[model samples]
Target: MCNSNSLSPVWRELKRLQSTDELFEILSPQSFKWNIGKGTQILFWYDIWVGVSKLRDQFPALFRLSGKKNEHIADMVIFSENGLMWWDIGILFPLNEYEDLQYQMLMSLLRNFKVDLYKEDEVQWTHSLEKVSSVAEGVRVMVKSHIDFEFDRVKVVWNKLVPSKISTFHWLAIQGGIPVKEVLSYRNCLNNSSDDKCAWCLDHIESIDHILLHYSWSHKVWTGLFKWWNIFWVVPSNVLEFSVDWSNGMGIKAEKVWKLIGSATFWAIWLARNEVIFNGSYTCWAVIVSRIKLKVFQWLVNAKVCESFQLYVWSDHPWLLLQSPSFDMF
Candidate 1:
């Protein structure tokens, strides 16, 4: 059983040292209705203990009006000498700007769900039949319910076979989360030096699509990859389209290989870009193509996609493995 005074140790351990704002993220998805045994455990402002939503969410104007955003249920509720319950808004607390209807709604909700300080507050999970769930389970449920932008390319970016950092970088690039010059300009991080040009080509702005696809060096890298695979497909205009449409006209096994190799292609280009940006190294298209080949081979072999592929065969005829009769054996 979880401790009645606090959230479960497992959940708390996951967010033990986090700020109150961060704690709201963990608590928001946890369908925990408070059975207030002692009112100390219930957050008066932020908790969704009474209604279908948190009080802060239900009455944002009223919540902002109150000075005690973090006050507990016990702090707000008090008993008279005659044993009647009433709210105590605290000494000199600002309570001046909420609509009358909002206050009436709040009082009405509180009246229906009065807390008992004598009993130890209990937390119940509404998400589970057992009224208990782990932090990881809660997080999974929250993500599944709330996140709306999942895509196949994004899913490929989180492949366990790929390095997490590399996958995360790929995900960010796809989402345009990288701090490119345009982004820096938007955030007012750049001086007026006009240094936002693609390091390889001084013609256009250094957007993610330009850096990964349209720039002269990046184009060469993609063309080189296509030639290596014995495919003459035209490159798509964007990364997502490139990822999804790159494997067209290939067998299922070939498509898997193509997707993994596609990830390697993006990763290699980013590495080359970083090399140029950070180390002031030159962007050699041939060298980048070579690196992409090597990276794809390494990831394939290590991830057990092509465990038996010799380095020499992988170097010369990588696509042959994908088309081989025993390709599934890999």
Candidate 2:
């Protein structure tokens, strides 16, 4: 059998295999590849022969409705007295609604690749990189696939120049994962009405955003820091938004310094917030601003972005220090 009708014999044998068959288990990994030179060995439906991915994974909807779900490419290709004839499985399967029309488009895509009839079809392992695959790199790619990590602000949080604890705190604050009063209330961690109010402002719910950016006390801290930098920009509404967009429209060196500034500001705000909440201490705006100044300088010096600025000078004229010709020693 060398035509479409020959698929019935092969389909019968595949159906007879038990559930624990090793052949089925061999395809368990999430990736595989096919070198479809002759297209004789690759299964058209069950194998990841086309689309650089498994047809089962890429087009699950079409695969479920397909009648010849286990047919090989050779079984569907007709080599008659007249030459080779390509037969799409649409004739054997009845697809309803949009799938009926979509099947033709899919078939056209399959027809585009030129099949070399001389070379034998070979199976290959598909990995993320074209280089030799290592278990460590493979695990890294696999772990990354499961995370919804699309945020650009992550660079600011995981900056190698900053302290690890400070970076972690900034990451948590940006993600709203910190156990602030508002979040605790939402999670039912707070039991009394007294725990619902902001520790610093005592006006509204103490959300992470509110405590970090919007509260009257914290507003002064952010604005004063911006004033110290001589940047006349409007403050962003949330920590994530601020971290991602705050350094835009600056040169490369300036942006690096600005990112350190943002990270340091977040760490300082969190430290001040915790002090007021847990220690019953009042951290004034000026003190917080000064902490930010010192923190930024410490991180920047360690970052090696700028080499020759004295601490007193950076504190007095922060933006001027960044603008000085000596700052070009990045």
lDDT of 2 at 122: 58
TM-score of 1: 0.51
The residue-by-residue lDDT of candidate 2 on 216-245, one tens digit each, is 887898789767766666667777666666
Model 2 Cα shift for residue 7 (angstroms): 40
Q: Once superposed on the true structure, which residue ranges of model 1 sit more than 4 Å away at CA?
A: 1-153, 247-253, 307-309, 323-326
TM-score of each: 0.51, 0.51
Q: In candidate 1, what residue range of length 10 has the lowest lDDT sum?
A: 15-24
lDDT of each model, Cα atoms only?
0.67, 0.64
Which one is best on lDDT?
1
Candidate 1 per-residue lDDT over residues 278-301, each given as its tens digit: 998986898888887788778777
